[model samples]
Target: MKKIFFTLVAMSAILVACEGKPSAATKTTEAEDSTVLVLFDGETFNGWRGYNKDHVPGKWTIEDGAIKINGGGAGEAQSAEGGDIIFDRKFKNFELELEWKVAKGSNSGIFYLAQEIEGKPIYISAPEYQILDNENHPDAKLGVNGNRQSASLYDMVAAVPQNSKPFGEWNTTKILVYKGTVVHYQNGEPVVEYHLWTPQWKELLDKSKFSAEKWPDAYELLINCGGENHEGYIGLQDHGDDVWFRNIKVKILD
Candidate 1:
């Protein structure tokens, strides 16, 4: 009888202890929930707006659970109503994740650390993650050794392994920026990694089309990159080509 009573008491004590503390998995999930911010809620443009404008462009819409650009197929010579769009908030160091797919022969880009200069385009003040139909888009063949291909640092550094899905298939992308280091992930694989504000970065800028002689304004901005604040808005390009993005989220990193 005494043994039975002791066993019951011990079991009750164990249960109390377990109930008092969350499991490791539960703790991790809670931490993730707290740090993550849903850039798009998959329903409306709650935290998005046109770059340099107050509202989202009419060309951008939610379709089939994704933020899609209804392009005229003109390729950057898009209508006045269509342009790049950006998240309203600025992030300094973060891990951004999204799923994207492009239409046949389409061209688009994901911009980070982008500043809104009154007359300058988004790409002028930000680095771009190239999005394209590698099999059909002319850009896939341009740039040095596929630097202009999907997942590449647009016209600067090529995404190694070149593992972009074919047009119309969803591809997962992750952009991690912390301190001065930037890493691009494609389909769960880290494809490109580089550091900003370094001598190597300066050399890269000097050789790219953003060189001081070619585009002085862009060169000046690209040199400093994120400006004095080291933070900027996330933007999506409307390159007059149909593109779809969904599951956009970010986790601010310390």
Candidate 2:
């Protein structure tokens, strides 16, 4: 009888301890909850703020599950009157992940810290993530010099080949920027990594078109371009080609 009573008490104590513990499933859910994708969940416009409210042009829509930018809606091709959608908030040091696919011969870009420069064009102030159909785009002919091609810094730097994936299929890309280092990744692989203020980078900038514009510290472009946003908006371009973007998300790291 005493043995039976002791067994019952021990079982009760074990049950109480188990009840206070969190299950493995609960832990996995907590980890997932910590990560948040910034892009819209569905083809619906849920997490974005329109660019230039009254001046927003073009027809921006969600088709099947992606954000589709139909050309000839409001702004002219490569013009200032086009439409742009930005995240509700701004970030400084973070990791941005998204999937994108472009149409034949089309051109567009994702700009980080893209803002207005007093005297230059809008793009001049913003750093661009080149989006294009490399096989069919004109910029591809320029070889390593053109920034207008796929994965290049839109006239600033040429993204090494390993960084760009083939066209048509969806490509997963990531941009990690922290302090003086900026790295580009394509399809989960790192292609090019550069330090912002290195002499080699500065020499390239000095010889590049950036010198003509005249900024005291040219390398400052990376830090100063996105005016109000130290970590600026994530913008998509309607390069007149049938480009599509979806599965956009971001995680801000302090």
Candidate 3:
């Protein structure tokens, strides 16, 4: 009986050696870190779709591992779907990370707290993280404390000026929202930061175009936590010109 037991133990040891434990590399790739948010993978469209609607137009295609707006793409408007792509899930306070490259003369922006008003672009309802070919686009040189360039709040607020990379190259942008503070960072540096509805911010809104157009919404910051909702969707802008995006991701904070 002792001899049989020894033989069985030896066999078990051999089996363990043959299989071993998962390698470090395998473990790293299999388990996604909760803090990391990867928006697009080259092969599929997951965690995304069109805004205020169910399907995305065909223009937003995946080519060469990037989400791009090909010429003559699809949209509800028939003008190559110049709408936004959004997270099916809403978030309150979180940080977003993404990469983009814009063709000369193209334009786009990321929008948040996205509310699709009965019939309007999401920009009318939510705040924007501006994207533009600053060197080529006409709107590139137009703001005082808001609007006019990349990372600005799209005509409502100006992002703090930092030299943007040339067109067709990858640019990294970070949008961090926690409580009443909203910040825009470019290439690992913060260019803009603003509290929702402080007197100064409201005054800026009061004097801006948003006052006349997005009037009530302009005052929304005055409400608690932008209407007591700390969570919303992350949207990509299809600025009707042409743009490209990849490595889109987000990390939610408690």
TM-score of each: 0.88, 0.72, 0.77
**lDDT against true structure, model 3:** 0.69
lDDT per residue for candidate 3 within 43-88, as digits (tens), equals: 6778778877677767688878888866433343345354677878
lDDT of 2: 0.61
lDDT of 1 by residue, 1-254 (tens): 34334544654355336644444445556335677888998899999999989998899999988999988866443456799999998999889999999999999999999999997889999999999999998888888999999999998999987999999999999998877778888998778877799998899899899999999999999999999988999999999989999999998765
Least accurate 10 contiguous residues by lDDT in model 2: 116-125
Model 1 whole-model lDDT (C-alpha atoms): 0.88
Clash number for each model = 0, 5, 14
Tens digits of per-residue lDDT for model 2, 87-159? 6556566678888887666677787655533443335555677787778877776645555567766666776
Q: Which candidate is the best by TM-score?
A: 1
| Clashing residue pairs found in predicted model 2 | 38-249, 38-250, 58-74, 91-231, 147-155
lDDT of each: 0.88, 0.61, 0.69
Candidates arranged by lDDT, highest first: 1, 3, 2
Ranking the candidates on TM-score from highest down gives: 1, 3, 2
Comparing 1 and 2 by lDDT, which wins? Answer: 1
Please report the candidate that would top lDDT against the real structure.
1
Which ranges of candidate 3 are over 4 A from the true structure? 1-32, 71-82, 212-226
Error of 1 at 218 (Å): 0.3
